[model samples]
Target: TRRHRCRTSASQCSFCEEYILWFSIAQDILKYISPRDEIKLPELELPNINELKQQQLKQQQQLLQQQQQQTLLQSARSSSKPKFTIEMSSGGDNQSTSSSLSLNNEEEVPANMNTIAPVPAAAVAAASTTPELKVENNPDAGIWITSQGVFYFKLNTLHIHLQFFYSVLKELDRIIDIDALYYLLCCLKLLILNDECLETAAKDNRGFLSYCLEKLLVPHIWKIFALGHGHLNECCVPLLLHALNYEPGKTALWNILERDFSSAHWKVRSSAGTRVIALYSLLKPKLIKNNYNVLSVLAYAFLNLITSIEDVEPTVSQKAMCSLETLGDASFKTVMCALEFQFDTVINDRSIILHRLSKLYTILLRNNSTIKILSWEFFLNRFDTLSIESQISMEESGELISPQSIGGFNTESEHFIRKLNQIRFAMAKTDSIKPISSSIRVPSHQRRTTTTVPRQTNVTSDKVETDSIGSFLSPETENSDRSTLQLLVNLLMKFMMKDDQNQVNDDRIMLKQQVTSNI
Candidate 1:
């Protein structure tokens, strides 16, 4: 009963009057720390190893006696010191002896070299005269190396797992070489548990990681950044990031972000930051969000992607970011929209897609950006009715729970709440910044650049065009319902896609008609 009562920690004691004696024993075995205490390493007293030395000395004495007896018997008939003494007797001058010993004095010489004396002339004659037989166990002087898992068998070192990627690169049959790259990615994912190891891996992966980073992870993120697609097979980005021990995305993942990611793309190689953001996004990028340098790069990366590229993929990135805002509860839709700056023709379709934007807000819940995004009142309006009891059922069935509707109890929304919540030190910076509504505005040229009611992109058209952003909603939405603005934008994008499909079908029809006419 007493033993059962003692459960968790050895430091605490569990006792009743019935178990007083057992409690006393537990107290003796288990020590408790007081608040003021600074526990030191236990002073353990191990038996002195001098006894082993003594035993060895005794064996050596017996060996010496036996040798001497043989020597005396042999000397009665002949005479000689042993063979090693002879081999060491390279009898040049004292200069040669000094030189041999002093050779490579980068470190101290072996002790035995100093102790061994020159061989007697008789010992030299022992081999030359009668072919002296010699034997030795070679127990005293040498090192033994063996492999234990990923690391060399060096018990003194604290390294738990260490293996080079190159070694594994050369595959051998039936041998599983340690994958340092995958291992490192794992280390990064467990950063919360192994932060020290994560940092170490970023450094160790410097050489080979670049090759994989460039060839694999970089492309994946860029595809996601610019293209918004990735295959979750073989090596998933999550697995790689986990092994890297990088914090979850948005936690400043760029700290371990590869500088060479740009080498894979002409655009990336053209500007290094482009590749980094692409690569950064692959690790889910939430890890490195706290880092100032990374944050700046992220901002720049967003600008480069949408402004210059005229493709559906750039729109995908914007869409993904909007979804991302949903995870964190922040409204990065504006920032993502801002990245659309500098585009030559402000394609009305690409300007905004409400479904995509709403998706961004949802994914925000999953990103490090989630908490920051959620601070807005816009998000709070979604689900305001459920109590805690209903909330549990909602979670069980994979139902929805909007951060906003959790009660809408607050007087002020997230934007206003956070503005004042910022540190007093940031007052100056805050004062200089304008509200999102005030700063964001469409340009006159942006209005002028509008083409006829944007139509769906007809890729099937034989007419060659360098670029296109399928058709979009009409400009007439200027008078549309404010609540439906998002829906209007989304519907336009859908229309563009549908137009692309129709163009493909129409081309098939015209081709069929032409073939029949020719026949």
Candidate 2:
């Protein structure tokens, strides 16, 4: 074999050509996404042909009437005048003077000229009206007038292909290529950067923008995030925020956010928590308008945030805590309602329940404004009832109540109870002051009657249980100390029974093995 050198260069490669073509297409797409200036003209009402003709006829009639009046006046004046004549000097002079007099009479013909002047006014009106009629009749004039009194000069070329763009956005998920998807998203973002383009896209088809947002944009962007393409999320956030301008889009965006908040992935939950805070900031003004839908969404968001605060993942929990703080700073009344609503619902975890109640109490204490003392008193009464029920269950089970028995009970709950006692003490001290009505009102759906489950017992025992737990300060504080103790005792009893069963099963298995060895 003979040694040979290749003469081909990298610039001439097919891949290089493809890259250049791609770049050119990308540039063209960007240029296409940019909005072109549209010229809007004021609506011009065209003069009706029949109306113009009537106006001309009226002008002509008026001119004729004036001419008749002038003729009558001229005839009357001429009849009122006497005719006079003078002798000429010679025949030739008389002929010259007669020609000169005829020229002067022709020059003094202003009366006929005045009558002719009004005729052109009619002609002028007709001339002015003709162009408008011709404009109305002509096809090439490029002006269109709708019955709504709007004038359309010309259609934008981009508008013709808007549906195609929307379809592409709708089908964005079907695109598998990363570069292609990124390019498409970039182009879409550029399109959204132009307010006019967004308006046109919204008006192009009813609910199309919202459908794309709810079904396409949100899910796809979240999918990309799930696939580890976080940078794409940045590109999509602006589009999502802009979608808030549409009513359907607003609802759709909120639904997606609510769904994502409950996602199994911690990262998704964290992102949703942050987005919720941002959305609340954006919608704070609308919340003031008392829109029922908006308030409902806000209530849901608050509930999600509260749940996320107890998330196992630190990242998500921290985000939720920060979000709650942000919301509290913005509107305390809304947060208060959400807390109360959560408390009213079924929560299995005693620690989480106490944590939320403590948070609510903290909020109430921080609030300097006079709130309904009765609401606080009502909660205290409920706590007193729960404490009594737990004590009755504990006594029925014959479990001893002690600090050591509860496995070194939660100091946080004790401290929270101490704070609650302080509040109660303050209320007692202010017995003379009338309770102010609460400015915050919980929604109807959140309201429920507190009904106690009656325990099976003799009438005298039931009466004694009720009487023993009736006092707010002594029973609630005592129950607060022993509530955790009661919970631990139950769990311990269940664990002991489970361990005994397990040991018995193991012993039976060992005996079977020994019998098999002997055989």
lDDT of 1 by residue, 388-461 (tens): 22233344346644222243244255532332222111211222211222222223321224322223222212
- How many clashes (backbone N, Cα, C below 3 Å) per candidate? 63, 0
Runs with alpha carbons beyond 4 Å of true place in candidate 1:
1-196, 199-236, 239-300, 310-519
TM-score against native, each model: 0.24, 0.32
lDDT of 2 by residue, 339-391 (tens): 33323221222333344434433443454323221132234333543443444
Lowest summed lDDT window (length 10), candidate 1: 143-152
**Model 2 vs. true fold: TM:** 0.32
